[model samples]
Target: MDPLLAKIEYWILDCVENEYSYLWEIRSVIEQRLVDVDKAKLDEYLCMGLSSVLTQGYVQAFAGIDFRGEEQLVPGFSISTSFIEQHKKAWQAGVEVDQDIRFLISDTGFEHYRQGCPPEYFS
Candidate 1:
């Protein structure tokens, strides 16, 4: 992995993990994908896909640390319940972000594999 990409991925995961306690798996997937990101690809994704808020948060988290991007990487976290609620509300509002988040659930209902969230916790 390019050093710049690795650093960026770590900052992303670190920020996201603060908000979404159950996203270690997702972070791992992102890290793997980042290994292929060169400077040009990183810039392209930033311009198109990723929000600048993420980078800002990372910079804030590590104040005084020099990062690759000109934008400050202020660390940020999403409120877990609020994060879930935003998706729920978006789905309800007929947003195409995805099918109703509620519909994504299986009958079991979020069996907790993580220590922070116990089984059937969302309800």
Candidate 2:
């Protein structure tokens, strides 16, 4: 496997181990296709797809990062140094930017932010 793909696979596996359903969706979509993603395509998917995932509150479970309102900078995490660097490259490549990832939980058949979220997440 190409190194990029190997890293991506490792990261995706980490995502699944963390029980992040949204990220799992990303992996599932690619895996189902059974194809390799070049750097450009990967970057595009991360920027656009990740944004959508974040907007849908999938990032909360997977990212361990907190986002508040639109003004806030969503938090970022690192599963691996190489993976993180690859992610930045994808962003620099101008992947389609859309929704921001935020935190929300579904309960009682409703979607809401997780309770007791710190007023200042960065603190």
Candidate 3:
């Protein structure tokens, strides 16, 4: 993995561990840690990293929670890898992700993270 991507992946895993899985919250922590990075560049890298994990089934995306704090349904659109890619493009074009999406590390993701994210995934 790229050094920045590696850091982002670890930070994301950490966030999931801490139960702070919302995109905004994860971004805030990463942005704070990478203060010297340009915002645009950071967003680009973040999108890429997120897309990769989601596509690989290492992370699951959820949306559309009801007022009762129950997960009504997983937003089918947001769960796709293409959605994440499009989101990254939109963000780069200055259009923000307007959905209320949250992420969770899948069991595979936890195993991968615990295994230090082996070099195969790095490629």
Residue 8 CA displacement from its true place in model 1, Å: 1.3
lDDT of 3 by residue, 1-123 (tens): 577777777777766753427665666767787789897666665676666677776677766443236543353323344544565576559875445567777788888788885455323
Candidates ranked by TM-score, best first?
3, 2, 1
At residue 7, give the lDDT of candidate 1. 43
Model 2: per-residue Cα lDDT over 1-123, one tens digit each: 344443333333334333333433554444444356565465444444344433443343323332232333345522333543554555569664344232232241122223322334212
Best-to-worst ranking by lDDT: 3, 2, 1
Where does model 1 exceed 4 Å of error? 21-123
TM-score of 2: 0.30
Candidate closer to the true structure by TM-score (higher is better), 1 or 2? 2
Give the winner by lDDT: 3
lDDT: the better of candidates 1 and 3: 3
Give the least accurate 10-residue stretch of model 1, judged by summed lDDT: 98-107
